[model samples]
Target: MTATVLTIAGSDSGGGAGIQADLKTVSALGAYGASVITAITAQNTRAVTAVHPVPPEVIAAQVAAVLDDIEVHAIKIGMLGGPALVDCVAEAIAGFAGAVVLDPVMVAKSGDVLLPDDAVDALARRLVPRATLLTPNLPEAARLLRDEAAGDGAAMQDQGHRLRALGAGAVLMKGGHGGGPTCTDWLVTDQGAQPFTAPRIATANTHGTGCSLSSAIAAGLAQGMALADAVGRAHLWLHGAIRAADGMRIGQGHGPVHHFHELWA
Candidate 1:
């Protein structure tokens, strides 16, 4: 059977991030993707000008529609509009018994906030416990913990474990925001912290990176890869996508990473 992954996220008009990115990534990785739009954004590579939340009841309906007919093996969630939507999603997915990759999408690539400030608590308190994997960049991790972003490896390790305590099965602390020749992502589990590092490619076009990565991991999980292996494969794939980003020349501002880099070449 073909693996199936459902993405519950916002619709990005730019075709770069959010639902667009998630679906593209799932398809590129040879998985079937089903999506439920939780919000809609008037956004592009430059900025997000406006956002409108999808009603909680409607969001729940979408969740039910997908889960009812499709045997979804994994789920990727991003950019919940606020606390209410967070609660809606949490309650809706309560019975699902598959890998849930939650990318706590707080901000966009263009520096615009995708999720509001108040929604952080709801996400941490409600959805964190339900996630099979929590993928948070430094800023988001700090926001979730109400602490400073990790400044080094030790701090990253500490924060990863702390996030794991919040009830996620595992937490992956992403280091893209840090300055270094090599970017290292730490995956924290009950066993210990495992580091996955790749040489940081110098690229200005990293749009949709987090979304695509989380979706890719979901794709792997849907195809039956273990959590650690899924994360590692997604990390390597995203590195190539970022490396090939400039080849497309997407927009005047930050362009999107190449979701189909391998296939296009």
Candidate 2:
């Protein structure tokens, strides 16, 4: 039987990020993909012009419907637009036995804010605790920590430890915004901290990196890979996607990473 991974996120009409990216990444990584859309965005590679959030009840219903019928092995969550939806999702996934990878998607690549300010507290309190792994980029980690600390090596380690205290099984602090030749990701768990580094690929086509990475990790976990190994494999796959992105000219602005780069060529 194929492993099934569920993605709870928003929808991007341009198919770059959110639900579209999550599903694509899951499929590319050889996992069955399922989705529960929390919101819809009129967005392309250029900008997010508008957002339409799914009602809280509707979001809850979708979660219930999927969980009741399917035997999901892992779940990837992103972009809860409001507090109500956050609460709803938290309640729905309270007892899931499988791994849950939460990507706290606060801002978009275009500098547009995807999460509401008021919803941050709810996400921190309700959803963070339920996540098996929490993946936050530099800015999102800073916001979660509520500190203006620099993204230095020591600071990143401290941030990962602090975030791990918020009830997640582990925390992966991404170093994409650290402004260096190499991007380093720190993974902190009960055992110890593990850092994964890769040479930075300079490109404008990084629109859906966060979504893709989290979903890829979920796919790995669904296939029964250990947390550290799952993260390691996801890092490698995401790096390849970033490198392959230069070949595709999808939009006028920042384009998306090629999720199926391995299969295509």
Candidate 3:
């Protein structure tokens, strides 16, 4: 059976992150990709020029329409942009029995805050608890954990545990934003924490790494892969995507990883 995965996210005109990247990653992993755009962003590799949020009712309607018609097996959420949007999405997908991958995309690639400072509370209280997996990069984890110590791996592991306590089934604290030769991500559950480590590939085509990773995980779940297996495959796929697109350039600033890297060569 073909797996259908949904992305509830903002639209990135740059084709890097948000729904654009989510769709690409889902399709690249051989899953049918569907989307409910939560916002429309005027953005490029360098910056987000403007953001227009979709109405909460419309967002809910889209989720309803999709769930009503399609067999959605998994969901990947990103760039909700505010508390209201986050709540709407959380409420819409609350009934879903399948996997949900929440990428707490609090900031843009240029370091601009994507979510409101106050919405962090709403995200933790309303959305994080509903997620099957919460994927937060170092900066996002720091914001969620509210700790300067979150910059270290040990602190990150503890933070992941705390995040799991926030009611997530699992918490994947991404260490890509942390400085080191290897990027280490910690997956924390009630059982314990397991780390996934990979060498940091220096490349400008990293604009969609977080979105792509979560989407890949969602796709794997949709296809019925085990949770740990999905994460490992996502890590491998993203590594290849980053390396394959290293010399290939697109926009003036950070470009997108080659989602079709395998098909091209």
Candidate 4:
């Protein structure tokens, strides 16, 4: 039986990130993809022009419709535009007994704020705790861990602890934005911390990397892979996708990682 994966996220018109990337990643990895769009953005390779949030009722309805019929084995969540949307998603996942991948998408590569200033608190208080796995890049990690004494690995550990306290089973602190010869990501939980590092792949095709990584993890979970193994495979898959994107000329600015790299000639 094919595993079903659901993405509760915003729509990126460019198809580089957000729901589009999540869908592609899930499908490519042999999982069925379903989506509950929380918002829509007029965005492209350049920048986000505008954002239109979907109504809370509609969001709830979408989630209900998908869960009522399909047997979702895993879920990936990204870009819930506001607190209300976050709440809507949390409510949807109330009884879902599966892997939940949360990509805390706030700042875009184009430097646009995908999430509002006020929504951060709500996200931390409500959504973060419910996630099966929370994935946050450096900046978002810092913001989430603002109370810790000076944002560093130590502080990140503190933040990760707090996130796990919030209820997430595990936290993956993605260090892609951290300035280092090697990109280091930490997977932390009440159990322990395991760090994974890889030489940074130099490429501009990282537009949808976060979305892709989370979706890949979800796919692995859907396929009944262990958490550590799922994360490792996702890392390998992303490396290949990035290398594939390095050779393609998709847009004028930052392009998307080649999602079909596994099949590309």
Which candidate achieves the best lDDT against the true structure? 1
Per-residue accuracy of model 1 over 8-125 as CA lDDT, tens digit each: 9999999999999999999999999999999999998999999999999999999999999999999999999799999999999999999999999999998987777779999999
Global lDDT scores for all candidate models: 0.95, 0.93, 0.89, 0.86
Candidate 3: TM-score? 0.97
Per-candidate TM equals 0.99, 0.98, 0.97, 0.95
Off by over 4 Å in 4: 147-155
Model 4 per-residue lDDT tens digits across residues 217-251: 99999999989889988988887888789787877
Name the better of 2 and 3 by lDDT.
Answer: 2
Q: Model 1 segments beyond 4 Å from truth?
A: none
RMSD of 3: 1.1
User: Could you give candidate 2's per-residue lDDT for residues 5-27 as a string of tens digits?
Assistant: 99999999999999999999999
Provide the global lDDT of candidate 4 against the true structure. 0.86
How far residue 7's Cα lies from its native spot in candidate 2, in Å, is: 0.3
Better of 2 and 4 by TM-score: 2
Candidates 1 and 3, the one with greater TM-score: 1
- Global Cα RMSD, each model: 0.7, 0.8, 1.1, 1.7
